[model samples]
Target: MKVVSCLHAAVMVSDLDRSIEFYTGTLGLAQVDRDLNYPGAWYQIGDFQIHLIENANYQASDGIDLTVSTRNPHIALGIQDLEQAQQRLLAANCVVKMSNSGRAALFTQDPDGNAIELTLVDPERESTKKFDII
Candidate 1:
């Protein structure tokens, strides 16, 4: 069997407001739904929805959530071009970390340090656009 599509993306945010700002304001993801009175918000990232949930109460053994999971536990987002995504991330002040050997992949982080990767696929092979959320 093959995976059909991505339903949603979830990120544990330390500060929900800041995370919302980065996702909605900076990243241009629209607010599909949000429980502002509560502790969560949902954003429309292309066809998939990104869920930002407040999780400051969580405390791991390391006591530092910033660099705990470093085995590339992140969502690999596809972009029209790697260079474009890099420029956008740089403009938004997202902390860029690494890039693939082929120069077609790059990594960045959210306000809560959740890794978000951008990959560029050759159009001849298979391509997709970074949709504009409506």
Candidate 2:
């Protein structure tokens, strides 16, 4: 089978409402679509859509399908402005990591402690490729 594109990504959350607040309020993700079928919310974060669904019914004890490194299968968000994104994350009480090149990246945990990495996109590289700004 050929992999055409990623339709969306799912990250189970303990609290649906708080997850919605974090994704929509703190991160500034737009509510592109939603469904009442389950305890979850869908958000548009740039090019890709993220889904935060309730995990209370999950049978697994891990709660989430993630590793201790928090590196595998991470949702790395690209921002238009690194400084501004860093400032926003800092305002939200997130820990920011500044690079030697002045670029900043922030690591934040969801209500479920899922690691999320947000970074600033390099303008030069973006101009050379098909980069999604939305």
Candidate 3:
């Protein structure tokens, strides 16, 4: 057996509506139709998907620093423009921290304290297996 690729990431949240707003409104992700029986939301980005599960008693881990710290575990997404993304996040009243490792990357969090990282992705360099400072 082999795990070829990641299917999706499921993060627990407290409020479904608030999380949906954060994921959709703030992150600019479109909510896809879901058939699950539970309270949750699914967002598709290219081939990857983010699953948000609503848990009223949700508890965050210690890594929920909500700051610019690549040392913590967070969802990292490759985007075309880092500066633009940062501006959008700031406009949405989200706390953003730029990567201090000389890389075009930034960090932010969702309404539920889910850490998210946005990094500039070069299509040509990505195929060459180039890595970021993280």
Candidate 4:
């Protein structure tokens, strides 16, 4: 019916190996095993995950300090109903983009082009922390 919790945050990284080391070493987040046929790594932090998608061409957002602005890099929120969420976003004239991966999720922007994802996921049963292979 409403946003239940933050599922994860998708961040674009330049180097997979380097970023992975930083996240698992410096940040001390357990790396979760993920094979999405894409260049990315997932890490576990309590009930939430940090998804890092490797992009050699990745560049930080303009002057706006995205860390506080919450733009470009996005957070995915767990929702009860996909259709209901989509309807609400659409009603507010928000642009919605369905997940191309066929998952029960949709993407939208927060007026500032910062991507927000609404996904149907149960965080309680979804933590990959226990399944950490690396």
Candidate 5:
């Protein structure tokens, strides 16, 4: 029922290769190999992953406005209990969205509309889970 740790932060980019180069060459983040089925790249930032997805339909922000909050990006967190977290968010009048793939995930937003993804960790496979494949 609690957020264990931040798993990843995903950002939409106009060009996947350029973003990956910047993150890997400039930021010095290790580029983590991922499945080719998806058009994206992953980098290892400490113990967490930074996912960069190419968005062809993304519109550039007019300007950086500190007052606007809904435009903020999302952060995904690892959760201890998916069901409990869902219940807690629902009790607080938060809109929870389930993953279409039936994965243990709950998507919600903060009061300001900033996205948050809560993912359930499989206890048995947590330590040995492989991300390169999927």
Candidate 6:
């Protein structure tokens, strides 16, 4: 399967409201309507989503070294097929973590320990127009 586009990038934060204000007020990202099913907020970045998750267990500025480098911040990419991507990653001996949200997602790491998330694209949400980067 091929990566269709970048879906979202998740960043952990201590305060969700503060981060939301910074992203929306400071950065001028439009806040989209989302279900508060979890401790996070979704912002519209052109056609992509920026997910700000409030993780009380972990702080973004924490200097503690982690075993898995990919456990830090990560970027999620949209893919054509989730199962095919999982199989490809497994075949390459890449460590893949399944999403607990039951969404079609696979989290893995690069050689440098950078986290990467592969997610299945929802056809209904796909945009046809190209995003103009300023």
lDDT per model, in order?
0.67, 0.66, 0.83, 0.65, 0.62, 0.63
Best by the lDDT measure: 3
The order by descending lDDT is: 3, 1, 2, 4, 6, 5
What residue pairs are clashing in model 1? none
- Tens digit of per-residue lDDT, candidate 5, span 1-134: 99878788777776677666545653345888888786888878547897777776654444423233223355665566788878877766766787555667767654333355667765555565433211
- Per-candidate TM equals 0.69, 0.71, 0.86, 0.48, 0.46, 0.46
Could you give candidate 3's per-residue lDDT for residues 18-113 as a string of tens digits? 988888987889788999899999999766799999999997776666444687778988887787899899998998988767788888888877
lDDT against true structure, model 3: 0.83
Candidate 2 lDDT by residue in tens digits, 1-134: 99966768888887778778878878888887674787788887545688887987543234433323233345777777766876777788754454323335555566666667676666656644455433
Clashing pairs in 4: none
Candidate 6 to truth, TM: 0.46
Clashes of each: 0, 1, 0, 0, 0, 0
Give per-residue CA lDDT, model 6, range 1-134, as digits (tens): 99988777777766777666655653346888888788888887567888777776654344322344335576656666778877776766667787655667767654333456677775555575342221
- Once superposed on the true structure, which residue ranges of model 3 sit more than 4 Å away at CA? 66-68, 123-134
lDDT-better candidate, 2 vs 3? 3
TM-score: model 2 vs. ground truth: 0.71
Please give the lDDT score for candidate 6. 0.63
lDDT of 4 by residue, 31-83 (tens): 98997998998987667888888888876455433333233456666565678
